[model samples]
Target: MRKTVIVQDSPPSVRLVQVGTEQAGQRIDNFLLRLCKGVPKSHIYKAIRSGEVRVNKGRTSADYRVEEGDTVRIPPIRLPRADEPRPVPPASFPVIYEDDAMLVINKPAGVAVHGGSGVSFGVIEQLRAARPQAPFLELAHRLDRETSGLLIIAKKRKALVALHDMMREGGGRKHYQALVVGDWVNDRQHIRLPLLKWLTAAGERRVRVDAQGKAAHTIITMQKRYGRYSLVGAELRTGRTHQIRVHLASSGHPIVGDDKYGSDEVRAHFARLGLERMFLHAGRLELPHPLSGEPLRLEAPLPPACLKILDYLEQHS
Candidate 1:
């Protein structure tokens, strides 16, 4: 959208601006969120719902995509106090691989990928602040905040689009390592379940196995079994929210320390055993290079605590 040229400092008023190529296709709410920095999300949603924000001179919802040259009317919003500018903390993460097109990071548990749901800052926000010179950076996939390991970030728009396509078509192979609560009897198993996302009575997001839900596929391969736990490799053929965790849990073996799906007793027991975080890790990612025809297999070793738990399980079991 047209930047400072449309708004004057002293004489602030309703400004109708034309969308630019770079800003095109972005949801008006997101566009407004960036433009109206520091404004609370509730205010943004209310403004859109109240028709205070207009696209192409017509009232639009928050999900409407802004087209190039489309006129967007932005209401005069109160700016955040000059003395209290919330800044994205520039934090560095362990870098696994990096190139002109993509970057791979071994993300740690408890850090959100992007801020929302009470999180003030996430990997993307921090990465943007870390390198102000970088023009474009976007997450290619998501990992649960409590899960740690390999994550991909695209440095170019084309790369992001290609990665999305690869993931959507099931061309990319994503595998995670999880320590479950019980021994895995099968050497290998394919789980084809329809998963439906629903809100619990407490308004928390949850997924359940339902015939009416979207199709999801996961392949569980037995790796090693402990006296009371099993280390399994989960290969996802279709990516869905909490796919691996939910699939394994549905099969009667919830992941250890998975507060969302695991048994409370098991989680508590594992926490007391020093496995404070979810015992799942995105240990490997394999796909053809988006630009190059060459094959690419990226791997991230489990964190020290996870390895120590595995060692303990091995030695004790």
Candidate 2:
């Protein structure tokens, strides 16, 4: 007769782990994300960025690949008491275009491009669920949760990489439509500002115009005026998070219903009118096809909510 011994998995706590043959060649970020059960992706990234995660007694980056026998120092993490309570319901957005190489969707407002910052799941998660048979799918770029319109998804790894390279070299033309609180002074305006991102005391993300920040450029074309507000077309020359929102606010004409950068008074005023969100839309996106080298231009009409607000402005004015 032979006796066998079993080892019990340990509880969640600060611990050191050694990479084994099976774990070798995995990115440190992905390894930790799988090892730390129930830890949010945001928390894992934060720890890596803040130098709390170490490898072999030295600070390591997220992209560092694990080698056999490399000791990883993982900090104590607070896991959710329960696993994601609800499964992501399978859903799909309005498809603007689809092909073997890629897909373009008219992403609705209030849905995050990908989940983080207290969101349990988002477009990518739901899309994967909806198309379980599809082997590869990934976001080519991101859109703010409050902003609506055209979004691109790559159905192949090669397409994803190619799109990234193209965007990096400024190959895409993205245009937005926004309604600002006051009449824009210039019919056409070029805003060149540097934007710095920082966190508030409450740990909220915010962006401001700063001389030392990354260079951001935006071109604004004033569309029409309705008493207290002006609709304008904003062309993004450099795609930065909150670039358009902060740039317009810096110029003294904040986008309407932009609670973070715009006025609280204006938000309340619009909220009372059933117009509860920032009036910003990704109206057009023109990009070269990753595989075919053909130019593809995608457009999404403004949502009904935005149309209702415009109608209200016209009738009330």
Candidate 3:
């Protein structure tokens, strides 16, 4: 028998893809990044800018969100063999709620919502791998890697769009539990600070309170006092990045285990007492169901490690 070896490096010709409900709601650049597995982002943008890529036979901007049934023309691009996407391992999390439209899970601390910024894969990728037959699954919002609790995943295009609109209009409630350093005075206080996102000299992302920044508001209520530390409930009115953390820090009480905006001495002391991660948990959420518009409330209790830290604080206080 003669051996026949096939070469897999041939560049594909231009193709037109009709966007489906499962692939809708994402920007054009992002859609190309996924469709062209090994193509560089610069090439994707260049193609979009030069009219090589088109939607409905017309050039479209990179930020344009693809809709269902829209035909996207993808230009041929050579892919290096080594740059192919690696296999994503299938994984699952503790499901708090699940319907045909959406999935809510009790996400743990230190696990990212999606893969990027040096992370190979995250919750969304892993869940997709785990449920290979799933038509659509996308993150409706985001939580910091160090924050643990209820996270929502949209399983349908309608649900994703509805959730995004609800978040933009502040139609729902998002509550978090935080253990912060300092003896907070007010029983309840609203911090209306403007925050601007900037990058450090080393290219690290950081947020700071600035007069010319976006409006950020957080309602803080004193839950308990532990001498030098205070347990507080944070209700977000504006969904800015690191809004809760920066607000609490500006009030002279950074989250206990937060490395970015916390005091070294305070964090070290808490570390000695078994506080392993940032003391921020998305403990509760209330919103209307995306499809049905019915009232819905979701909750995730403190994990074992967080409970242990609370126990120590209570005992010491």
Candidate 2 off by > 4 Å? 1-61, 65-86
lDDT of 1 by residue, 176-212 (tens): 9999988799999999999999998988889999999
- As a whole number from 0 to 100, the lDDT of residue 2 in candidate 1 is 37
lDDT of 3 by residue, 1-317 (tens): 11111223245777777787567778999777666654667789999999999998999999999887788888788755555454667788999999999999999999988766777678987898788677678899999989999999998878999999999999999999999988999999999999999999988889999999999999999999988889899999999999999999998999988989988887788778877789999999999999999899999999988889888878988
| Range of the 10 consecutive residues with the lowest summed lDDT in candidate 1 | 2-11
- Least accurate stretch of 10 residues (summed lDDT) in model 2? 1-10
- Give the C-alpha miss distance for residue 195 in model 2, angstroms: 0.5
Candidate 1 versus the native: TM-score? 0.91
Lowest summed lDDT across 10 adjacent residues in model 3 is found at 1-10
lDDT of each: 0.85, 0.85, 0.87
Provide the TM-score for each candidate, comma-separated: 0.91, 0.79, 0.87
lDDT for 211 (candidate 1): 96
| Position 127, candidate 2: lDDT | 90
Q: How accurate is candidate 3 locally (lDDT)?
A: 0.87
Q: Write the per-residue lDDT of candidate 2 for residues 1-317, one digit (tens) a residue.
A: 11111122344555778776545656898678656645778899999988888888899898998887888877777754555642567898999999988989998888998767888778987897688677567788999898999999988757887888988788989999999989898999999999999999999899999998999999999998889999999999988889999999999999998978999999899989898888999989998899999998889999999999889889987
Stretches of candidate 1 off by over 4 Å are 1-12, 81-83
